[model samples]
Target: WDEEPFELIVSNPPYSVKWVGDGDATLINDPRFAPAGVLAPKSKADMAFIMHSLSWLAANGTAAIVCFPGIMYRGGAEQKIRKYLVDNNYVDAVIQLSGGLFFGTSIATCIMVLKKGKSDNKVMFIDASKECIKVTNNNKLTPENIDRIVDVFAKREEVAHFSHLADYAEIAENDFNLSVSTYVEPEDTREKIDIKKLNAEIAEIVAREQVLRSEIDKIIAEIEG
Candidate 1:
């Protein structure tokens, strides 16, 4: 970071990597993290990297960074940082990706899109967790899947069970939890079952079983006689 602002910033930093976050008392005074009024925990440097990218972002710039899901709803210092981001309208969107998309791990990850200048106070949440095709051991997003995500994000449209546009008030009510699942309702795909029909089928099977048992016993008795 040479103090020069960039129009776009993108990164996929290491997950939950430890850093000299709060451990260094003066680190909070740094302009990048100072706005949040608190530093990312030393154990989890996720937000710290975000702050760094945000600091170097231009006025109309947008930074899209992949992040661990925990930072979305984690409490304490992380919550405080999230509160700051939401209150300032720095967060543009949060996209949830499917699990098993990477090697060595099957944990679901999220993308936190940050913008210095936002057109609106609402934050868009896109749940793209189901937009992947299983490829060998990892899940891969096809071109169509990527296009759908990009289109929804660009349009900022709220699709039922897929995306949501949450206002600042709603975010405040939820304590600044930016988790996509919190905003976008996942579709319930489980098949519906009729209890009455199932019970009748079980009863019919039991009746057939009883009749077969009776017939078999009668045949054994006849043979013996």
Candidate 2:
């Protein structure tokens, strides 16, 4: 408990595992949880790990933790902790990756980047949900995909439909929701159809069907006559 703080902290902790949370009354007073003004819920320990990482982080450290999607938008204690991080400029960036990237589950996960020393009040959000390719039965991030994500993270650029830099006011307006989708919009990949062209095609199909029906009627009349 008396070692030097970590300059970089990275972890993919057990997602949403149960923890003591506020059950251990003393945890509220812990330096890690105290600044957040509340403890993570006992049933969801995701934020607990975040707080611990933040505490152990050196003044210039950056912590990147893999998190479940729920932790990004869950209300109550988690929201309060998000507010604390955002207000204090500890949050650096949030990246959402495609589902099925991990084994045994197809649930999408997000990476939350936190820093003890930040140069700005804006938080960068990256929507890399479509950055992976389907490999066998699972999705995998190829070297190219990884490079794309890393490039955006490194430049902190605002790429349309890919990344966004949101200020504190924007986060506050959204009620402190840290979900990447809130900032970086997903690119609409659905095919664009011209309704007029589609309707014309349908009209042509119906006209051809009527002509065929008329021909059949004439053929039947000739046989009857």
Q: Residue pairs in steric clash, candidate 2?
A: none
Per-candidate clashes, comma-separated: 0, 0
Estimate, for each residue in 119-171, the C-alpha lDDT of model 1 and write its tens digit: 99999999999999999889999999999999999999999999999999999
- True lDDT of residue 91, candidate 2: 95
Q: Which residue runs of candidate 1 sit more than 4 Å off their true CA positions?
A: 1-3, 193-225
lDDT of 2 by residue, 1-225 (tens): 566699999999999999998889999999988999899999999999999999999999999999998988989999999999998999999999999999998999999999988988999999999999999999999999999999999898999999999999999999999999899877789999999999999999999999999999999999999
Report, for every candidate in turn, its global Cα lDDT versus the true structure. 0.94, 0.93
Query: What RMSD value applies to candidate 1?
Result: 3.3
Q: Which number leads on TM-score?
A: 2
TM-score of 1: 0.85
